[model samples]
Target chain A: MATWLLLTLAAAAADFQDQDKQGHPTRAVLLGGSGEAHWNAGASVGSPWTTVTVQRGLRGGWTPLAEVQAASFARWQPAVGVGKRWIDRRWRLTGEGTVGWTLQGDPIPFRGPAAELRVKGGRAVGRFAPYLHLGMRSSRTEDRVETVSGDILREEARWETTLTGALGTGFLLTDRVGIDIGLDLPWVHMPNPSIPGMHIGVQTGWGRNQ
Target chain B: MHTHGVSMVRTILPFAFLIACGPPPKGVDYRGTRLAVVDMHLHPGDWQQVPESTQGYLASRFPFPFGLRPEQVAEGVLTGEAILDQLDDAAVSAAILFAVYAPRTVGVATNELVLRERRADTSRLWGLASLPVDRWDESSEAALAALSEALDNPGMVGIKLAHAHMHFRMDDPAYFSIYDMAVAHDAPVYLHTGTSPFPGTRTEPEYTDPAYLEAAIATHPRVQFILGHMGYDFIDQRPGDADTAIDLAVRYDNVWLEPSALGSRGSDPTGTNLPLVLKKAKTAGVEARLIYGSDGPQSPGFAADYLERTLTALEAADYSVEEAQLILADNASSLFGIPTFKAEK
Candidate 1:
């Protein structure tokens, strides 16, 4: 995901020809929500246990664009793929779609290639912005349950998906530096191993155009 | 002339735009202002249980009640649901969880299980793995290998050792193996010094003396040592016998004191007696050397409440608020390498 994010950013930079009237690409640092990925808990009876998606936007726009990401948790393995973004800057609206394969890590019920969508935006206060996001995500999960007689009776695996939402605020310190605090509803489903539910994290990047 | 003017205008344009943009509004320090319950000593309770499935197949199992099964014999053991309920009811945001079994005796199986559980529950659980200090014959090699294995695990944030269980003094060359291991891991060691309960426990009131640790610290300059039980003698001994322990922790730059059994179980071991230790830590000007710890199952319900009460009692006994915060959170965070308590904007 990082490699692809960087590549896309490089492509964006190559696109910026430094035209005389281009206004220097509006280089403002972004410390806002990355709604490109929506985390979901196992709500469906036959879905993966947990799913996590981390992605970045190489450029800003209101139309769908290409992206890369890795999704995993439980039996699910980390997968990399191409994605698209949809944005409506006026009301701070944004959405994303991605497809990738399970690259590495533990693999079980999970299969290759996953997809996601997110909508977000609120009020932008100069260098800081607060946003709300809602999204749906899908993946696969697997487990090993032993028998009473000490035998491996069965391996349970399934492709699952969930709906998630979060509220967050971020600071755009410079064209390349930013920070964000988000509260995500880890699992929207029941009967799943409760892990990595609600998380608070900070991310910093350099050479980010969005 | 026109091109020169344009270049100058471009330089000023970005500056003018930045000035017009102004600065971002400052957010409140939510964590600092909030009343957080800091339980210093806690363990991932379920991991203590011997997995029934793992045991059922065996012809004979270790006599120890392993697994989540609760027996009336011990007040500290709790079921999985009950353990979660305690935190849910307490509004606790942080806890320092440590393993109780001597790593050398209990082996890595139990410690490994505990670490896995703590990693899965990071927000409320900070796990300190037990170091294998029971085997003193080859103390250095055993300590190094055992601690290295436990510390290599990312889930393991710190090292835990009990002088009583290991039968080694903090100063003994035999135990320096553990110190060397902890230094290599870049994590803190929660040394079980001061006092213990079991009869014939190696750390007697005299040998458990905190001074023993000074030379070790001098030799192992990089190790960060946390004195457990507030330096209180474990078995019945003279009152305030841990004075030397307190003095050493206060005097040493690397030594730390955790309010574990001291505030709840010690020479006068009771919830009420906790304040005295806090007072001593303050009077000694080593308040900042103290950190939070529960020594659970060893004590009762006071772990969650002691942190706040200890601070209040210290102040009532003439300690400063600054001293209280240092003991409750700041020092522990610094000593244990807990990034959560670091200052940030």
Candidate 2:
């Protein structure tokens, strides 16, 4: 599934590159809902968690994003990503990739990184736009300590991948003000342990592009 | 500009309403049944009586960084009502208190102190007589006599031996009589089974090794034994000692492992070692033998943090609420026959 998603992303990137190269003079900031489902040893463990993301767009269609997420098990993850966007008279699209790190030291110490890919699309109305997003992510976690002689003393790691989708409306209140509300759903991809979860978020931002 | 501000408010108001009415955050609801906590290892020292040199020794051994004077260390010692206050604040229903009897390393907090405190509140404080068998005249009979008298205190739940600090092995003949008395009384025996990093104290790992207790555990199956620290060697990166402890717990049905100082041990605030130990227990199918202990209030403000960390780790590991309840209190409650509260409906 990860291989398929990676190939699909590559094809989408190629298609975007071949489109008519047109640049818009605009800068925008955005806030939205984010979330993920985590699995270990082929079992659904942690509860679903809501996450908040803040993003700022730069010139040349580049945007940088940051997010924070946590759950009741004292699980916490903070992430950062960058992406490219394309906008037209009645439609907007974006593709982003991010890296995240996990922290929770008991039952076991989890130390590792996760990489994600997100593609989003929106339809423009008078001043409000409703959007949908599809994303995929993979994570690698391990806890271990070793001796100076390069002996593996203790080690434990779990790898997982998830698919996510979201629905939301973006409101352009003025030339420089906007607000966004969204519901995020994430599905863990594993047999006999398909735990699903939902998260909602509201984000308000200011930028000339609105 | 005024119209633009009004438009912004109009747009933001609905978003705020949506947020206010939205479902609670994901994964925020813990399904595990909450159980009353019983702290199994607490050393409420008589800090004022400790000599300046010993205070200095303790300060040096402070798990986290220390910048306090010896007097400050002494002043910070939680005693009398202070111990109760901390327990209340941490929501711990009861604690098993131990006297410190390593006379050579640190002056004794005589068994009398533990008995006295336990007398103040038997329901909330259980006493464990600390035996400095090494300090007793080299006669097994003399040590057994001292232990027998301490056990005579109805409030004393068990005997605590600082084998590592006093430089003695568990299987040594000098302590066999004390073990016999503990078995006769049906009192559980608590042994310090890990290496300590204190600068002035004896730290021979062999003396505290869990493997050394094999013969004793086999000979005295009636006497339950709690291996404090699960034989962890905090100063080292390897898991050899901890594995040894886990192996012992797996091999001996009468043995249980308590991760007391792993979280409070200053060095690994993240307590990565705990998970490793828990993972091993699960693999060995010995989760029932794992108990919760906070070697604390000794390091003020540690009880709460340690409990939170242990619970979080347990939850993250996919341990069922029933399992969490067991580790949190049921195991210790059943082991020591202490009463615990049930989850409120």
Name the top TM-score candidate. Answer: 2
**DockQ for the candidates, in order:** 0.01, 0.01
DockQ of 2: 0.01
Worst 10 residues of 2 chain A by lDDT: A35-44
Interface RMSD (Å) of model 2? 18.1
- Quote model 1's TM-score: 0.47
lDDT by residue (B187-233, candidate 2, tens digit) is 89888887775434566655767888888888889889888888877
Q: How much lDDT does each candidate structure score?
A: 0.50, 0.64
Backbone Cα, N, C clashes tallied per candidate = 20, 4
Error of 1 at B322 (Å): 2.9
Give one digit per residue, the lDDT tens place, for model 1 in B298-338: 22344444444555555566755555556556666666666
Which DockQ-derived CAPRI band holds candidate 2? incorrect
Model 2 misplaced regions, further than 4 Å = A1-210, B1-32, B48-54, B60-67, B70-76, B135-139, B237-240, B343-345
